[model samples]
Target: MKYFIKVVLAESYKQHRNYFNNKMIYVSLFLWPLLSFLASYYSYKAFDLEESAISYINSGNILVFLLIGYMAMSFFRSVVQSAWRFSSERQSGTLEYIYLSPASRLAVLMGNALSSVFESSVVMLVFGILMIFYNRESLHANVVGLVVVMPIYVIMALLWGVFINACFLYSRDTDFLFTILEEPMEIFSGVKVPVMIFPGWAKLLSCIFPLTYALEALRQVTLNNSDLGTIKITVLISILIIVVLLAATLITIHIVEKHVRKTGNIILF
Candidate 1:
């Protein structure tokens, strides 16, 4: 266990160091969240709503809403991006090198996930601070809910990574899948508005989205004053998702490992 933790931590730090060292990338990392904020502010402005109402809505609760949406996007982005990292390494002939290591595949993926977690943390912190300053609202963040729900959120995030990694292992062309998940997740997951506001059918469909559990969990803690019942239900669903996804990922990897051993088709030509 100690060895595995060291390996994951080392790998995570290496990835984080490389990524953070890229100045241009860092600039864009900060800018993307800002762009989301600007778009949310102006898009609402385009409706010609009263300036005070718009300010109240956008800078206050609405701004938090937009930030949370982007936060979910950040998680999705991390999962997809981490999956593609494997494909990219394969193309560059490094995938096998990593796989040849003795570490568990899940450990390696967890390390990559840690990299994403770091990036997302930075994004959330920077933007969260900005939002707090702009809105001037006392955060009064829920410590216990944040602690409990975060693990579930991390597990749920892995589903996207595992699915994409499986797709890359088989087809090697998953851009369409990525695009498909992007919008519907943002739309149905209460990124822009409350999911309760959705029509019956839409709400039903959205309930299946992984982000639904995450948003609900976060909303209960942040908006509803740490509603334990809501958090418990969301945590349960998120745990189920993580288990299912992790199982699928392992199965897929085993199949691919077998195929590669038999046919030596490790690289797609």
Candidate 2:
């Protein structure tokens, strides 16, 4: 138990010091999402939201609604970008040495994920909270639901990062994974739009992302003031996603190790 805790902490410290050594990173992290959020919010001004299909959207609550979506998105999106960044480990030749270490590989991955979650979205999260407070009048949130769901939201993002880190372990050329996931997650996960308003095929694609479920439940509780019972299905789906990702991460780590031993190479292809 002590060794595992040490491994997690050591990896977390390495990740933090190696990539997030500068204070300016926090400012940049907040700015990117803020720009995206502004662009998205302004684009809606050209339309009449009251006439929109989604029942909850209106001029009054639109600002806060969008804030919640973007805030939830930051948690999941930052982790994806972090995993993609970690791919450079192969180029640096540190990944092989880390794999050769005596520590548990899973602990190393978890630690990386943990570090990603803590720093990547913090600035954005704080900004979002202040904005939400400003527009508190526009919200209809369930206090209990928000309290319960917040931890799950972070855990889901952490597990997602771990799963993505495992997948990126296969190869150095992981730009394709970055390309496919980042934009698609933003679009299909209903960050700027609601899944309920999406076309049939688009809705089907949205279900493929765990972000879709997380954001949906988040909006349900925050915008609609829905209770735990009302969002039981979404919560169940999130739990299932968490379980599947944890198992897949473990399996992928085993595969990565085997491939390294057999080929004496860390890069899969």
Candidate 3:
């Protein structure tokens, strides 16, 4: 276990070092999150809702939902980034060379996941701080609960990342799936609008998407300033979903990897 940690950390550090050397990546890493936040904020402003309404929203209550919803979206971004990046490397035959090394596949995946995760977290933190300042509201929530729930969300997201990477390993064309999933998630997961606004059927469908639970969980912390006790139901549901989805995702990955090898199409691209 200790050896594995050292390898993963070394790989992750190497990846980070390479990323830092790329100027475009560094600029995009800083700009994308701020741009996303500004885009959402401006879109809302364009609605011309009264200032009073907007100010009330800046309150910790409403801002928390937005904060968490974006965070959940960040997971989706991480997975897509990982999948595509991996696929690109595979297409260039670089991934094949990497796999020949003695390093663990999980360790390599962690390195990839870390690259994307860093970008996503940077975006989230930037947007969150901006929201706090814009609202001029001091935020408070269950610090302990936030800490507990975050790792679960990351685990869930990582499962999806694994599943997607597995798909790319064989099909090498899951970009369509990624795009389709991302668009709907952005629209229906209550990122820019409240889920309450969705009709019953729409809300039900959206709930089927994992991002809904993530957004709701974060909203509990950001908007309601609620503790773990207050939001136990949502947390419980999220925990259950994460467990089931992760298990299924991992199984699918194993099956897919084996299938690709058997078919000799692991490099399908």
Candidate 4:
């Protein structure tokens, strides 16, 4: 137990130092998300949100609404992109060395996910909080609800990253996951749009991403003052997703330990 904790701490420190060493990286993280957010906010300007199909959104609360979605997304996105960076381990042969070391693989993976998610989201999370509080007239969450749901939201993102990292670790050619998960998650996870009005087919597809559930619970708490009891089903589903992700992460890590990647890609004609 002590060693596991030590590994997690060491791995977390290493990830923060290695990737987050540059102050510009933090600025870019803030800038890119802020830019994407501004673009989305403006696009909705033409629409009459008062007459819009979605009940919770309005001109007054739109900024807070969108900020929450993007804030939550930063957590999930950071982890997925960071996990793909596990490829660096494979490329440097450090992955094999780490495997040979006595450290617990799961602990190391969790540490990496933890550091990435926290650093990636902290900037936006703080910004969102200030905005939400500034727009507190539009905000309506219970303190108890925020206390309960916020941890669930963080856990879901962490586990989601861990699951993705484990799958990427299974083989060298899994880079396609980065392609499939990154853009598609932002699109399908109801980050900018409400799932309520989505077509049945789209709704079914959205369920595949855990962010959909996290965002639902999140928006409800912030915009509707939804307490745990009110969002219990969403909370339940988030818990179930977290459990499934943890199990999948462990299973994938085991498989990854025994699997070996072959050298060289296909030769171009």
Candidate 5:
């Protein structure tokens, strides 16, 4: 257990150093989200949605609604970033060294996932604070509910990252997978709009993505002032999804490791 803790911390420290050492990453972190948020806000305004529609989607505070949705999207995007990092490790030859280590592979992967979450949370925090300052009037929520829900939300997002990383273990290239998943996830997960407004087919797609539940639970708690009890169904679904993804990730890692052992190569292709 102590060794696992050490690995997590060591990995987190490495990520922390890498992130802070590069000034542009910090700039891009703040700039890209801010730009995207503004673009989304103006685009929605151009549609001139009815006040009732806005209220249904975001409690009538489009700024805060978009802010929270974008923040959640950013958090999930970090998981993809972690997968990209895992792929990069393979390309750089460091992945083989890590695989050869005596440490548990699950622990190493968990460490990487946790580190990505940590970094993403920092960026989200900064953007969230800025949004709050800029649109304080748009903010209305049960603060206590948000506090309770956020930890679980972060865990669910990290589980997604671990699952994606596991999938990449068997692939030589992740670009196609990332490309296919990224936009659909953003659109179907309610990052730019409410899932309630989605078409029937889109709603079905939302059911397949765990981010849908996360965003539902989030908006329920933070925007609607609902307690955990009120969103129990969504929370339960999120937990179930996390469990299933974790199981799949474990199975994938086991299969990949066995193949690597037999073939004596990390990259099958």
Candidate 6:
């Protein structure tokens, strides 16, 4: 337990030094999301959407809806970034040192994921505060609900990061897969639009992505004024997804380890 905590802190510090060392990252972290919010807000305004239509599609207050969507996307971004960083380590030959070390692979990955999540959360926090101030009149959410839902969302993202990192361990390049998955995930996971508006087939596809449930539960609790009981099923489903993803991550790590040992090829070409 002590060692795990140490690993997490060390990795977190490394992340701060490596990525947050730049003043530009601090600026871009807040600026990019703010730009995204503006783009979506103005684009929706171009449609001159009716109050009823906006309410139906976005659960009212398009700004708040887009704000939450962008915040959620930050979590997913953390997962992808962590996975990509892991792949970079492999490319740089540092992944072999990781494999040779006595430290727990899962612990190290969790540390990496946590650091990414921490950084992403900083971005989310800044945007969240800005949203609250700008849309103070329109925005409404139960503070208790946010307190309850956010940790689960973070855990889900971390599990996803671990799984993706494990999968990347077996691959030389992840660009093709990342390209195929990223945009579709943003769309199908309801980052910008309500999942309820998706066609039946698309809805079914959305179910395969945990972000769908995370967003649904978030919107329910925050925008729709849903009680914990109302979102119990969604929360349970997210937990189940976490469990399944953890199992998959463990299995992948075991397989990768065995394959590396057998083939003596830590970096796949």
RMSD of each: 3.9, 1.6, 3.6, 2.9, 2.2, 2.3
> Candidate 6: which pairs clash?
none
As a whole number from 0 to 100, the lDDT of residue 59 in candidate 3 is: 30
Q: Which ten residues in a row have the lowest lDDT in candidate 5?
A: 51-60
* Ten residues in sequence with the least summed lDDT for candidate 3: 51-60
Assess every candidate by TM-score: 0.80, 0.95, 0.80, 0.94, 0.90, 0.90
Alpha carbon lDDT at 178, candidate 5: 84
Query: Which is better, 5 or 6, measured by lDDT?
Result: 5
TM-score, candidate number 1: 0.80
State which candidate has the highest TM-score. 2
Clashing pairs in 2: none
- Against the hidden true structure, what lDDT does model 1 obtain? 0.67
Relative to the true structure, candidate 6 reaches a TM of 0.90
Between candidates 2 and 5, name the one with more favorable lDDT.
2
Q: Give the clash count for each candidate.
A: 0, 0, 2, 0, 0, 0
In terms of lDDT, the poorest run of 10 residues in model 6 is 51-60
Candidate 4 local lDDT, residue 116: 90
Error of 3 at 83 (Å): 1.1
Q: Candidate 4 residues 50-87, lDDT tens each?
A: 99787778888898889998999999999998898766
Q: What is the lDDT of residue 80 in candidate 4?
A: 98
Model 1 residue runs over 4 Å out of place are 17-20, 45-60, 133-143
Q: Cα deviation of 191 in candidate 1 (Å)?
A: 1.7
Model 5 CA deviation exceeding 4 Å by range: 18-20, 58-60, 267-269
Which tens-of-lDDT digit does each residue in 8-121 have in candidate 2?
899889999998999999898889889999999999999999898887789888888888888888888888888887887887888878987888988888888888887888
